[model samples]
Target: MSTIARTPTDDATRADRTWTLDPDRALPADPAVRPIAREIYAETKALPLVSMHGHVPVEWFAEDRPFPNPADLIVVPDHYLVRMLVSQGVPNELLGVPAAPGSGVVAETDPRAIWRRFCAGWKHFRGTATRFWLETELVEIFGVTLRPAEDTADAIFDQVARAIADDAFRPRALLDRFDIEVLATTDPAWSTLEHHAALAADGYGDRVVPTFRPDPVVLLDSATWGQDVERLGEAAGEDVSSYRGYLAALRTQRLRFKAAGARATDHGHLATDTTPLTDAEAAGIYGAALAGTLGPGDADAFAGHMLFQMAAMSAEDGLVMQLHPGVLRDHDRGRHAVFGPDTGFDIPVVTEYTRALRPMLEAFGHHAGFRVVLFTVDEDAFSRELAPLAGVYPSVRLGAPWWFLDAPDAMRRFREAVTETAGFSNMSGFVDDTRAFCSIPARHDLARRVDAGYLARLVAEHRLDLDEALDTAVDLAYRLPLAAYATR
Candidate 1:
C-alpha cells in the first residue's frame, strides 16, 4: 500500500495553481452592510492582540527556539487539522505525531513527504476554518502564493523551510510580529512556573502569563488525581491530608499562580453542573476521593461542588473564573489510551446550565469582586441559557462561541443569538483558544470580519446607527476581551 494520499489531479503547473486570497474574503457581501463592515474592519484590524486564553506553551517563548520544520510547526499539535485528516483515513503516525514522549518516531517519516500527504488531502479542508488559517499562514506569513495541492506541496514546503531558518521567524521575533500584547497559557496549579519566571527575568513578564487550571485534582476518578495532589502539596508547601488542608493548599496554589501573573482560572468538565454540596457533604466526598473508594456518582458530585468552591475562591482572590463544560473527553478510548488527552476526540454533548449552575449563581451572581465567563459548545444553549444568564448577572459575562463552534457561520450565529440579550458589553470578545500559534492572527482576523459583518447588518436594519455599529465592532474585537479578563 502507498503511504501518501492522492488528489484527483497532480498535473497543475505553477501557472495553473492560482489560489490568491481576496483581502475582503470574510467581510459582509450585502451592499448595505459591506460599506459599514469595511469601515469597522479598517479601524480594528490592526489593533494589538490580547490573547487572554490559549494553550500555546510558555517554553516556546522562554527558550526562544526556532521551529523545527514546516510540517511539525503547522500540522502536528493542532487537533482541528489532525481530526479532519484522520477522518480522511490518514494515520497519526503519517502526520508526525510522536509515537512516544521524547521519542524520535516522527523522524522515521520524511518531513517533506508528510507535507505532500497533507497537501494531497487539502480537499478535505476546502471550506473548513482549518483551510482559512492554513491558507493565511501560507500566503500572509510565509509569502507563499500557490494553493496547497499534490503538485505544489514540495515547492510550498521548501519556501516555508527557508522562512523558518530566518532569525526573524524565531519564536520571540514572531511574537513581536504577531503583535501579541498579552498572552495567557493554560497551566495547572502544580506548575513550577519556571518558564514564566524565566520570561519575567528576561523582561518579557508584561507580555505572557499563565491561567490556573485544576482539573486533575478536581476530578476524583482521574488516574493521576492522588499523585497530582501530592505534587500540589509539594508546590504549596502545605499538608493535604484533610479536606480543609486540601482547600487551604488549593488557595495557596491560586495565590502563587496570581503572583506568577495568572489573571484567571480555567475549568473544563463533562457537564455544566455547578451545584454545591454542604460543607459536611463536601468533606465526606473529599475523604472518599483520597481513599480511592468514591462511588460512581461521587466523582461528578465532588467536581460540581468544587466548581462552586472555585467561584468562591475567585471572589476572594479576585481572579476571573472561566468555565467551558459539556465535553465528553477522549470519546475514542483507543486513541486516548495510546496518545493521551486532547488528542482530537473530545466530542461535544448536550448540557444544561440553568438548573445545574443555580446553586453557584445564586451565591455569587452579584458578588462585587467575582466575575465568571461562561463558554459553551452547544449552540442551543447560547440564547436559551448562557445569554440570559449574562443578561441579568452583574458578575457573569458570555464567553465566545467555543471550540467546535468557533467557525465563521457559528460565530455569526453566536452574535445574533447572544447580542439581543447580553449585548456587546457583556461578551468576552474573541478568544483564539488555540494551540496552533501561527493560526492566532488568522483566528482573530476572522473574528473581526465576522463581528463587523454582524454589526453592519444591524446598521443596515437601522437598529443601530453607523457610528455606534463601528464602536460596537471595535469593542467586540478589542476592548471587550481586555476588560473581561482584566487582572482583578
Candidate 2:
C-alpha cells in the first residue's frame, strides 16, 4: 500500500522518485546569489498570505463541507488545467467540463477517469506555473509521495482522497492551515452576499470579504445585459427606465457592497479608456440601450464612461478601484458558446495607458480620496506607461503582474521593469488573483521566491544593501498589500 512521504521514496516503475519538490526552486542560479536568495526566501516563506483579489466562490466557505473528491476539487473547476488539456486535443467532456444546455457535449462523469486522464497528460504542465502549484499542493498539503503519472495515478488519487476526508481539510480549516490572513472573493454587482453575511455571523467577517465586480452590468455588449440590468435594478430597488435611475441603482448597489465589508471594486474592461462622456451623451446611449436601439461603439463609449463614473464613486465611498484591461475575452466563440466564459480562451492585446487614461488621471490622479491599482497582461506598458503613471500619480499604485504574467519569470521581469520608476511603495504588492482556492499559498510562495532572487541579485551587484533588500522583501510579501487595499 503506497501511503505518503515528505522525502523521496523508492518506487518500482520510477524507483528514483517519491516526491516532486526542490528547496531551491525559483531561486537564483548564480552560485553567490543563490545563498543570498535562499536566506531572503527563508525569512519571508512563513508570512501569512494576503489574497486581496481572487475569484474563489464565497459559497465554499459558507457551506464548510468536505470537498467531494480530488478531480472536482483539483481539476474540473481549474480553467488553467482544463484549458491546457483542451488545447492538447483532449475533449472537454473527458475533463468533466459541462457544456451549456443543448450543446450536446456530454461531460465525463466519473471522477476517477478524469483524474486518470489528467495524470496521463501530466507532461503538458511542464515548465508551467500550474505544474509548480499542483506539485506543491500534492506534496506539502496532501503529503502525497508518488509523482503524477499514468502508472501512479491511482495511488496518488487514493492518497489525496483519504487526506481530504479529514475534518482539517474543510474549506474553513484549510484557510487556517494555509495561514491566509485575508481572502477577498470577487462578486457580481447584483450579488445578495448572503454567503458573506453567513460568514460574518460565524465571526469570520473581517477574515473573508467580497469585492465589487460590476462587469456584467457595466459592459453593455453582453447578450444578458438586459436581463442583468433588470436584476441589478431588483437588487438595488431602483427604477431602470431612465439613465439617472440606472446610475442610482449602481450607486446603491456599491453602497451595499461597502456595508458588506468590501474594500475594493474590480473592473475588467477590454480597454482602459476612461474619458468621460457628457451627461447628454451618456443619457442618449443609456436610453438607446434600454430601448434596444444601441448603435455600434455606443456600448464601448458607455463602458469607458462608466469607468470614469466608478472612479468618482470610489472617491466618494473610499473603495480602492482595481482596473485590468486589454484582454480579448472569450476568443474562441464556438467553445465559449458551449462552455461559457473563464474556460481560458481569453487572449491579451496591445494596451496603452498614457493617452488612454489621461482624462481620468487628470481628474482624480491627485485626489486625496481616489485610489486605483493598475494591472496589465501587456508587459510593454510596465516601464513605458504604468510605472511612470504610478510613479507620478498619488492616487495610483501599480498592481502586481496579472493573469498570464503571474509566472516566476514574468514576476521577476515585473520587479526589474517597474521598480526603477515606481519603486517599491508605489506598488500594490503580491495579489494571488486565482480562482483555485488551494493555489493561493503556492502562488504567493512563488512570488516571494522570485522577489528574493531579484533582491539577492541587487545586493550581489551592490545596488541595494542586504538589510534594505530584506526589508523590501517583507514589504512585497506582506506590508504593501495590507496598506494598498486597507479599507478607508
Clashes in each model (backbone N, CA, C under 3 Å)? 0, 0
Lowest lDDT 10-residue stretch of candidate 2: 1-10
lDDT of 2 by residue, 1-488 (tens): 12324344544456235665788988988999999999899889999999999998999999999999999899988888888898899987799988898998888889999999999898899899888888888888998767788888888889889988999999999999999999999998998889999999999899899999999988888888989989999999999878899999989989998898899999999999898999999999989988889999999999999999999999998999999999999898888888887763889999988998998999999999999999999999999999999999999999999989999999988999999999999999999888888888988999999999999999999999999999999999999999999866
Model 1: how far is 2 from its true place, Å?
A: 31
**All candidates' TM-scores?**
0.95, 0.97
- Badly placed stretches (over 4 Å) of model 1 are 1-18, 100-109
lDDT of 1 by residue, 23-90 (tens): 77788778877888888888789998989989998899999999989988888878898889889998
Best-fitting candidate, scored by TM-score: 2
How far residue 205's Cα lies from its native spot in candidate 2, in Å, is 0.4
Measured with C-alpha atoms, the lDDT of residue 385 in candidate 2 is 96
The Cα local distance difference test for each model comes to 0.87, 0.90
